[model samples]
Target chain A: MRHHNIRKHLSAYAHQECSKDEHNIIENHIKTCIKCALTVNEYQQVANFSKQIPERSIPSEFIDQLKRDTLKNIEISKQKHYPPFRRLAFAGIFLLLIGTVTLHIVNPKTPVEYISSSDTLKLDEMEHLASILCNKENLIAIIDQPIPIHSLIVTLKQMKKLNQRHGQVNNMFERIMHQINGNVLQEFPTPLSSCKIGGKFDESGLTQMITCLRSYQRYNDTITFRYIASYYQKIRS
Target chain B: MELHQVIQKYQRPMVAIACRMLGNLEEAKDAVQEAFIRFWKSDTQIKGDPFSLLCRILINHCIDKLRKQTFRRFFSITEIKDLDIMKSNENPHKSLENKQLVDHVEKLTTRLKPVQKAVFILRDMQGYSIQEISDLTGFPENNIRVNLHLARKNMRKWLQPILKED
Candidate 1:
């Protein structure tokens, strides 16, 4: 091997890493080569000097302290990163829940909302009354009872007139009208129930009224028709 | 593996490497401690050798300290002293001689560029094979070899006059 080749292998050679053949080659060559021999010596000294640098004795107390301190720091970081509470909860989702709760709590000043329109407020109140007055069974019964077209028209007109004046109709018919009017307050006059018809009529009494109204419908010239006609005419005017 | 286990395994070697790099025992301990702390905090897995990754973190921290040291030196600030590494009540001649050699070698190392110094320390001082050094540092073997060669040559310039006595 050339001098440079042997020099490259010198570190390996110093560590006894070279193959027998390669080691012999360097040995024979360097025996004649003064510079190569000195170079090997220098490499040896370099290795020895580095190894001679004493291992700084880590104090026994220092080792224990380091372990204790490191464990403490690890615990702190783990807690900051993932507290036990967060681990029990649904990880990232818990953070989102915390943020949501914090947001709700941060802004506690809920402004009182005012109805911009009195008409709208009244309509909402009427809608609420309709919901409460017309229970599901009562609504279903009124719908199931078959009123002929004439009774239906007369009942609607009377409901409209009653809503316009008192809005205090008996609960039973009031429920029926509220249901039939599609729960729209405008469909009946405002202030429902013009006068008390004693107490509410049961299903049978309501059927009787439907029959009477159907008879009355034939007399289009009757006073009731005149009154109904006059009311519509007045609304139109 | 548990974080304390990894720290137990690597702390001494890491502190040694950091001491050589930073030239201050306390600073080296702090740097290695920080490395352990970082390893504990990282959610990453140790790909191959846990100790190698920890050394890499520690060496990077040492380099950052060296950079800060440079900034301080530029301002003519006094550097940390109290670099006593010898065992007390030993033979005075051997202790003083070893101290002088260590001082001279470390002083020569400080002259070398950071990359070369690290390569030299990894290879010569720490007894890491070139391949192991490459694996630990992510440097190509050729780059490590070149730096090691340069670092050794630089040190030889400082020590050659004295090694003639040996």
Candidate 2:
């Protein structure tokens, strides 16, 4: 190998990746040539120092914020028309919400029934509702009487499952409660309790409460956490 | 648990390469952030060697940013600052007197073509083999050899006096 050839292959020679023929030629040329030997040493030092340089670390705050920003962008993208992949994600979310809510209403673990005057029902029905609604694992909150606490729990559970269902329940509560309170002002809906339905539980008013609760539930409120998703992959022993 | 820990552990060499190549702490920081953001967002598989993949991304991003006129003007302005660069504890200079060596390396880096700068950073500074350099840059082995050879020759000519004295 000539000086130029040896110099060109010096990196390969250092890495020991040169073919036997090329390696031997370079080795022979370097032995007989002082300049080639010096050049090889220079390449060695450069390669060595290159290894010593450390990789960079970006700030944790920047990364965390970037992920949040990306997620926000993804959410915004869903609202508008997006590319196919993102459109798919938006469709998936919509489908998931519809599926969960429909399942909750259609195939509930406990059948829903209304309380009425005239019939003296068995305590077994109330006990079943209590067991289904008031159980610590199931209840998000309790509400005023006349509408059994179990009914409220069942509705709340449905609301927790889907934003649309939550809105529906909120409207139902406000309309029915306002009518009852309007008929009997002497009853509850006190100043302190009035905020629960904003002093006039109209259909719209109940819808607003459900909306507020939905917002909280959507973001994850501990007050209504019946089934917390576990994110831990494994717990170290 | 935190992003910084991952960067600190896997990205130190990449940061060092960018800092050495760009010779600006702030720009190096930005380059690293952009690279990790790309990594975090990308569905690309981070197989085998995370460090190698990260270094490639960091260098490539920095190279692109450095190509911008605004960043070039910024570099020209910062070049006049003559600040003493701080070294990470792990990167303490073997010879404090070799400040001249650092200067020589920095000057030679500016003369390298963008791809050559990346190739040199990966092979010489980041301790990657030619094959690994090829993997990161998507260059053929022959092309890598040519660029690396030219890069080494340029550095040798520039640093000849400094190395000889040391």
Candidate 3:
């Protein structure tokens, strides 16, 4: 009958669940009693073996299916609540406001300062030379001086037209556009030192730009010649 | 993304436990698949240690299966058939050690009520806490303690004889 209390305390001892006073009582009883000690030892062994029971691997496929199904349900729920027309209306209103504000600052009508400058002949020759060079082999190549700015602008316009017509521009047209957008092409004539070497257009400079673009082809297929023309010498609005 | 993967992950342990408890492959597989279906349908709340939750689901499912009229009759016939097959076997020595362990556990388990058998298995074999057993079985903590005590006492009576013999 006395063993009942001791036996009751054994599981608590095995699980470390006894209060300090109960724990000391159990410990004292265990030392004196072989039966309770054996019981505690057996319970501990069982507990240890139970812990070793191998954990089963949950199938990865099951988890993945659950995730997919949950996401699908979420998407379906979202669609029911948030319709396309409402989303489109919010986006359209946002874009319209942005467009109005941008137009106020970047007024497209402002003429470029370079157009009113004194060197009209150089500019005209540049334009003429640009047009003549349009059919030139390796169109990415630099033109030696005496080329008119009008010819250059016309050539750019023609390339733009060809790209628009065919819906694509080849690598050569792409390289030329890169050069025009590059720092070398953007530099003004007064500090022409950086833009000039040996008082002629840098042919090697043009070749290097084309080679650099070979790496870009993998990422960009459209071959965009578009640039922020507002920052450069003017094109009529 | 696939129910197949979830089944694969839980299958080994689930199969082992189900086979051990139900003592047949077909029933074990059915129980496991049904458990999976239940898991799929739940919006929430099968709380606490995933393994314990799964074990509860599987054990309860097997118990429910055993309760059915058809399964109860079939299981009794199968148990008799199994005993007959074992007796017919010539090589008794091969099963001796395993038989000793199984006999001891079975003797201990037969004395327990169904709930006691489950709580005992969860506590002794599965190493669940009193709280975990309560959570799994929806028994109160005191009821789990009483059941577990009765289970251990039954087992202890057998163990006393075995230890004395040793």
Candidate 4:
């Protein structure tokens, strides 16, 4: 091999990292090549000097501090994973309450009752009816009524439109109509009961019912003529 | 092995490797401590040698620190400080000479890329075999060899004038 080729391996050569055949070639080359030999010597010297770099003995205090810090970190991590008894108890109770509320909303205990045609409701009774339908205390009862799945879906869509309109239009005409005729009408149109649409009371239907009631309560501040008009519009449509 | 025992047994050597890689004892200690904490947090029932695993963790941590230091150095105006050369009471003259040699080595090694510095330190300073370095660093033996060769070549170039002056 040329001197240049042999010179490239000099670092590995100093460390004896070369193959036996390569080592023999380099050794023979170095015997005749003074420059290559000098380069090899320099490489060896660098390796030797690096080896002589003293290892620092860790301070005893540093070890103690590291142990304390590491153990403290481990303890903190352990606490993170396994919470304390009272905190765990609080979490458990909080979860139980949430689960109970969810279960009550999902599957109410109040049975479905059919409203008779003679049980006419006055317009002034809308507020009382809304309170019964949308009140948190009566939420389970409202969800328990056997609402037709199709009607609930339709009502949910209408209620969403009403909510969007209520946000956009805050005119005096609508507000005045709401205040004057809000409680004076003579009949509460039971659109839910009037619809005998055949459908199963499934999860989707219950969800729609809950959503409609939620929207009704949400827009309670403006539960005026427009809302009743929207109901009538739903009936006519 | 238990964690405390592992810390007690391997702390010195691991810190030595980190010191060489980082060129600072305090940073080395921090890196070694971080490695130990990571080992504890990780699944300890590791498949292979625990020491090698710990070495791998420490080395990677040091490399990450070096990268961040390089980045900070790039944007910041601060100058790099010289390493704290260890002093010896037995023979102050010999200690000063050794200190100069160490300072020169530290300066030369810092010029190398992180991986090259790591390979050079592991092979030349710490006396690890190429294969062991491969296992510890997860780099192929050929890659380690190339890095070692480049690192040594750089060191030789830098050390030639110093050696001649001596």
Candidate 5:
């Protein structure tokens, strides 16, 4: 090694990490080089002195106590972080409460007369269906009652017309009505999908209804009346 | 047995190592305590020596703390004054002069860079081999030796005045 490298490795030389050849070179270089010799000697002296400096004395009793305290603290910290279980339980309780409320609203005591293939849904039936939805707090037309094609047809027309007039005011209910209408069409196919109210009973029809409703919320009443009047007229024809 | 039991076993050595690095018993204890808490909370699969893993974690924790302190010290001149260069307790086993010497030595160590200080504590004080330090620090063997050499040189300069008086 060069003198510079020899100086750097002197601590190692003092600690005896050198091979014979490397040791001989550093040893010879240090002997002639006074600066290297003094520096190496100083490094050796410090290394020896450091060995004598008392190891950081940690009292065993203190450390044992520390371990116990840390163990206790760790448990506390874990509890602090582990709040999800409680939150999940709260969520479960909330869902159960909603399910109960939903069961009460969608009860079977008020039996709905489903329209069969030979029968036509009368104007009273349409009025009853509209009143059931329009009177409720959350006015979406999913009543959980057994529904025939004619009543559903009337329900779709009323919802579409209501969406046109008042949907902007009650945006959430309008969206729900839209989703339920789509689901009924996709999941339950019917031959008489369109109603006498001149509504297409599809997503586009709902959008037009919402646009018309957006013009004036009161326009919904006129749309609803015409919707029922046209359905009866078409069925009579 | 468990992580807590493992802490109970090796905590003294870990504390000693931290005390040397941080130069304060309370901070050292905090550092060691945090290391165990973190290890217990960790998802790491310990496939090797648990003792060695814990030691590495403790050292890294101390080094990180020191690095932050160093950064803060750079912006504020008074910050360095807060370093509590520790002193030995009044033990019947240790003489006053011995405590003075150890205390003086610790005071000298406060001037060292964090890496050099860690290397010195591990190699000289803890009697760890050069290879072990390299493995623990993930520094090259040569790098550990270089820091060890610098640490010794720095301590010697501090000791020179005392040594001459003696």
Candidate 6:
């Protein structure tokens, strides 16, 4: 073999990775070639130095720690695979329960006092009645109560006639009439106008007024009537 | 074989290879542990020798760590010290000499490219055959031989002055 070819195989030859024939050829060649022999010696020393670096023993504590950590990791992965629907179901039920509790706290079911128009209307109770008209819970509570339909209609008519006399109460009457269904005023005879002329309604006329007022027994009509009645009573006092 | 059994059997050799590749015992242990974790998490069926598969995982992990080390070194001045493999109480003079030689070898190995460093350490220091290195690294036998040759040449050139002084 040529010198370059022999030198190229020196690493594999030193490592005993070359074929037997190639090893023998290099072995014989190096015997006479001092440069090749010195190169082989350097290769041997390199290999020896590499092997002398020493193998460390694995620490027992490290193995035990690894085992503990691996087991812990596997357990965590198992928890991650837990059924998603079960978590969703839990969240849904929790939200439903919170909604129910909030509803109860916000709008409690309380006894609603029945205030007829014939009841002694005090000025102090006007504020309380106004609050009842404004509060949703109170409005919903009074929804089932008997509404003084005829009395409310008469009071609204008297207030409307007074509104024409006093320009200041015109806005308040207009607002109250708007809330009480202004069309109802066109349907009913202006009873207060007849009262100003000293003329009384016939029995049939009273029946017509009662029938017209009964149609106004809806919740919104009741709230509007309560508000107007209280304000009219306040103005009269 | 069971994973625990594999650990018991191959962890020593794995740590040995990793220590030489990384030059740090703590990092070697960490790399070996990470390899076991990866092997455990992998869904692929073990179709070949378990030891070879484990060594491949470990070597790849060590190479990634070496890259990260280089990246960190770009922004910092800290150096990784070579692990002292010999106990000082055995023979202080011989232990010191061996330590110096091991340090020199580690420093020279670090200068090599990752693939060349792996091939050289497995072939020379760990005493694996070229075919075994090929099988473990998934490289062809010829590729492994070329890398091994280049690595040895570099080591020889760097160690010439040191060896001559000794």
| Candidate achieving higher TM-score, 1 or 2 | 1
Which portions of model 6 show Cα errors greater than 4 Å? A77-237, B71-99
The estimated TM-scores of all candidates read 0.50, 0.45, 0.40, 0.59, 0.55, 0.53
Worst 10 residues of 2 chain A by lDDT: A228-237
What TM-score does chain B alone reach in each candidate, compared with the true chain B?
0.76, 0.67, 0.61, 0.78, 0.76, 0.77
CAPRI tier of model 5 = acceptable
Which model, 1 or 4, shows the larger DockQ? 4
Candidate 1 lDDT, B31-82, residue by residue in tens: 8888888876666876666987787777877776777675544322221221
Clashes of 4: 0
lDDT of 4 by residue, A1-237 (tens): 898899989989988999999999999999999999988888888888888877767788987776667667766776776546978898999999999999999976523232111233333333343444433444333332444333334434443343444532212223322332333222343334432222233423223333444455443422223243334333224
- Looking at model 6, give its docking quality level: acceptable
Stretches off by above 4 angstroms in model 4 are A82-184, A188-237, B47-49, B71-99
Task: List ranges where model 1 is wrong by over 4 Å.
Answer: A1-28, A79-237, B47-49, B71-99
Please, what are the lDDT tens digits per residue for candidate 5 over residues A40-105?
666666666677877666777888789888988898878876567888998999999999898888
Better of 2 and 3 by lDDT: 2
lDDT of 3 by residue, A201-232 (tens): 23233333233233333343222222221122
lDDT of 1: 0.61
True lDDT of residue A41, candidate 2: 82
Q: Which portion of correct inter-chain contacts appears in model 6?
A: 0.56
Per model, state how many residue pairs clash. Answer: 9, 14, 22, 0, 5, 0
Q: What is the lDDT of residue A197 in candidate 5?
A: 36
CAPRI category for model 4: acceptable
Candidate 4 residue pairs in clash (backbone atoms < 3 Å): none
State which docking tier applies to candidate 3: incorrect
